[model samples]
Target: MDKQIYDEMIENLYWAFPLLKTKLVKPFDKEEKEKENDLTGTHMTILFMVKEKGSICISEIGKHLGICKANLTPLVQKLIDKSYIERFVDDKDRRYTFIKLTSVGEDFLDNKRYKVQEFLKQKVSDLSEADLMTLSASVAGLREILMKIK
Candidate 1:
């Protein structure tokens, strides 16, 4: 892409960040409030990551989320306290610990998944088939480009 186009894209991204965050944060906050849960956005993100990846080590989770170990330690501890996840020592390597979702965590995730699906369906149902397809393709392309970065 040309420099001007690239600059414009970057500028647009900067402007879109807050709007995107607001779009995500509001629903999540509402859901949490409805459930009477105190989980923060970061905590919910960690749960979602674990749900997506199944079992993962703390270091791996931190790396995947672009967070450092020091920052993730307390977050993992909080999840453990909430009984949403469990940390177990690797049988073969005592030095490594793997984190996995507990049954409660899985249930929570299932509920969240349903809510998200329902929300998306309601929000996008009015779009034409072609528009939906274009949006899907655009999202896939964006994911590919993001994966290539860093």
Candidate 2:
């Protein structure tokens, strides 16, 4: 790729960042904020991680999330208070604290997932079928290109 072309692509990415965030992210953020629950985005991410991992240690969750244990503690505690998660000591080890989602946590995650899915579906409903296909193709091509990059 020509250096100038690559530079222009970088510039376009910078230009696109704010527009994409405003168009796609801000509305969702606003909607989520209006909900009765007060789970921050990071909290939701941790809940999903716990769901996917089945049960995970706080230390391990921190590692996966790039959060240090000190910062991770309060978030985990808040979830515990909400009954969204539970902490237990390992039966064999006894020293390790493992966290897992409560039924409430699972339901909470499901609700959030459905909302985002519906929101995205509604947002794209106005796009023509051909435009949708083009968007999908462009996204796939970009993914393939990124994978081939260092």
Candidate 3:
């Protein structure tokens, strides 16, 4: 990539991040502020990843989260303690341990996802028809491009 293009991409990312936080993240957070969370952000992330990957090995989850096994241990343990996830030793290979969300965990995630989607839908419902079309196209393009990144 040319230096100028690289710089522009960097600038766009910096600008987009705050807008996303403000327009997407903060609203749901404020609505949920009354509810106290028992799990930390990392815990929620692990649950989301496990839900996404189905049954995943401990080491594989660490790799995707950019967290080493040593640091990830306690976080995984906390989820297990909460009964949100289960760890099972692979039958064929005793050395491998896998994680998967329990029924409770799946319900928890489903509720959270539904709430966020509904909230965002209501937030954007008032957008002008043309603006909504443009926004939808921009989000589709962004998702397509971002998916190319690993």
Candidate 4:
């Protein structure tokens, strides 16, 4: 493939990420939130990542999200304050700290995920099995490509 074509593909993919996330994911997440303390999409993403990874250092989280420690610190602190995450100094290394989702965090993720799953289930119920398989494969391919990029 030509370099220009690859560049355009990358650009388009970058732009489409936010659109797809907002259109498909955000509505369900926002639906159950209280008006005063609604979580932003970025916060929910960080929470989800931490929950999935079990425990991770701030540096690793920053690297994965293409953010800096200075930027991530406040967000992590906010989650800590909300009791969704806990930070602790590593036993082996005093200088290093790890962040993990608390039980509350896990509950939040499960509830929000249930909402998203229900939405998807209803939307995809009428899709042909072959079409569903195709989408699953395509998403796996996309994840592989993204992993390589990282």
Candidate numbers, best TM-score first, in rank order = 3, 2, 1, 4
Model 2: residues with Cα > 4 Å off, grouped in runs: 1-9, 15-17, 138-150
Question: Tens digit of lDDT per residue, candidate 3, span 127-148?
Answer: 9999999999998998999999
Writing each residue's lDDT as its tens digit, candidate 4 over 85-123 gives: 999999998898899999998897898788778988876
Q: Score candidate 3 by TM-score against the native.
A: 0.87
Over 27-144, each residue of candidate 2 has an lDDT whose tens digit, in order, gives 9889878876688888988898999999998888888789998999999999999999999999999878999999998998898889888998888899999999997897798789
Global local distance difference test of model 3: 0.89
Go through the candidates in order and give each one's C-alpha lDDT: 0.85, 0.89, 0.89, 0.83
Order of the predicted models by lDDT, top scorer first: 3, 2, 1, 4
Worst 10 residues of 4 by lDDT: 28-37
Model 3 stretches with alpha carbons more than 4 Å out: 1-4
Better of 1 and 4 by lDDT: 1
Could you tally the backbone clashes for each prediction? 0, 0, 0, 0
**Model 2 poorest ten-residue lDDT run:** 31-40
